[model samples]
Target: MALAEPFEIARGVQTESETVIVELTHEGMTGVGAAAPSAHYGETTATVEAVLPRLFEVLPEDPHEIDAAHTAMDRVVNDNPAAKAAVDIAMHDLVAKLHNLPLYRYLGLDATETPTSSFTVGLAETGEMARKAEAAVEAGYEILKVKLGTDRDVEIIETLAETVPDARLRVDANEAWTPKEAIRTCRALDGLVEFVEQPVPAEHPTGMARVTEQSPLPIAADESLVAPADVPAVAEIADVANVKLMKCGGIRPAIATFHAARAHGLETMLGCMIESNASIAAGVQLAPLLDYADLDGSLLLADGADPFDGPPVPALDPTGVVGTGARRN
Candidate 1:
């Protein structure tokens, strides 16, 4: 049986979390895993609840058979993203445990290297944004992802650029701007921001194409991409694609989307849905192949039990284990 547990986080905004837990019982051995959905993607408590019952029906008894797991996931996709992610991660965890392999190893990810993760500075006033950026920099995050798209977008970018002048910076609008505004904003912040994500709505790719063609900084699509089906359009308009397991509905689709993005000459980023370590761990399996990463959702949680959190926040080692490196200052 698998269950979803909800947690609350105080980040750029106060948000509720619903993480799914999968329980596998075979020959008296049990294993557990978790998944979380993105609220920005229209996932909610009720959405997760609606899909749980159906997911349990086809749950596989064996973890080694990726085919069976894929079939189950295909069925679960009928549900919302949160539900699908919960089910998919739980199954992956079970299979990895059954095989006595780390989840990342099971997925064939480079385990001995720790990829640099971008710490996000959520939407705030210019001064506050600068302070947050400074704090993240002081904490040793080499990359800083800023949340923009609000009315104060320009001021926020300028403040961050000044505060963490040397840090690699990326911005995510969460689809908060119109095409014209996106062009104006990206051009305005060109030198300061490394890239801007999903400035316009996902439904209007042509508009984004226009913005991408005219903008100074590169653009990455976040909400605008769902499955491999949407990748072609996004590739045409955006320079990068942000792949979230929750948004892609699960790892299967996320991998497919990754390959699709690569084939289209677009950069790839592994993004998270403000999730816990369980979900982040699943994402970590695919991190080695990504050009950019935003899997720091676990860092934003005020209270949560994460196996990855050691004496100091562990840097991802090449082996994909959490504790393989010296703690960063």
Candidate 2:
């Protein structure tokens, strides 16, 4: 799908996110999923497509048995987490549809307990970012997640806070700052943002620890927390851990990471890459278990081409439940 506008972050700029949509069919029923490939994770559309035959080999004969399906997916591939996530979501969607329940409710979650997903604004000039901030607030977004990790981080934050003073704001540095730099930046951005995300490189937990210990604002770990096992190490320094479905493999692993992070005394944040509603919907299903959410990838997509005939871009209901999953037409 095309982006409503080009999205820029510390990493780069893009006008669109390309995703592979998948369909799982059985017994006169069908389930759908989408995969957003990431070069950071060493994944691409061609790579994801290459793994499909292996995924098909382990296709769950019984979609209702989600656990078995998930395990089968885990066994099918070693590093194609996004591809595994697509198959995982499709299996879960199929099960939920068969049970005639929404995906979150089918998983026994309290839909009312979920938090609203944050609308993200990628990095840009101070004036440009503020304009995007204004548009997001006008469109009913109560919380805004901004991309930082640039020299103008503080300036951008100050301008955006002034532009939408009432709207809650958060910033993701994406591992751009040094230990000392992170501390200084965090101190400067103290009241401007709710928290600072990945202010230091993922490779330096000690730097993150130093910033977390000295900074006034809470620090959230995005790059550092990749799996359930990776949670405890980062939780030692970070206050919040950001869980992305694409990053952690899929729903089952994401749930595991959330619990693990909580066990280590870290709050949870549900986030996503530039993704379609297929993956965004799966993340929405898990939002009830998180303290924060940045699952607005689909909202940035000019079109999701959502084959499921559901609301692809979420409404940012800070108080209500958002629906998810796909069905056969």
Indicate which candidate wins on TM-score: 2
Point out the worst 10-residue segment of candidate 1 by lDDT: 1-10
* lDDT per residue (tens digit) for residues 108-193 in model 1: 77645555788887776679779878988898987988888678888888777877888988888877888999999998998887
Give the TM-score of each candidate.
0.86, 0.93
Deviation (Å) of 38 in candidate 1 = 3.1
- Position 134, candidate 1: lDDT: 93
Worst lDDT window (10 residues) for model 2?
Answer: 314-323
For model 2, residues 1-329, the per-residue Cα lDDT tens digits are 68888998887888877788878887776777878988888899999999977987987677777678667767767878888888878877777767666778777776576677789988888898999999999998989999998888888988998899999999888888889989999999887889989998889988899999999999999988887789879888899999888888788889999899999999999899888777777777776788998888877767534333334334422223232554323
User: How many pairs in model 1 have backbone atoms within 3 A of each other, for residues 3 or more apart or on separate chains, i.e. clashes?
Assistant: 10
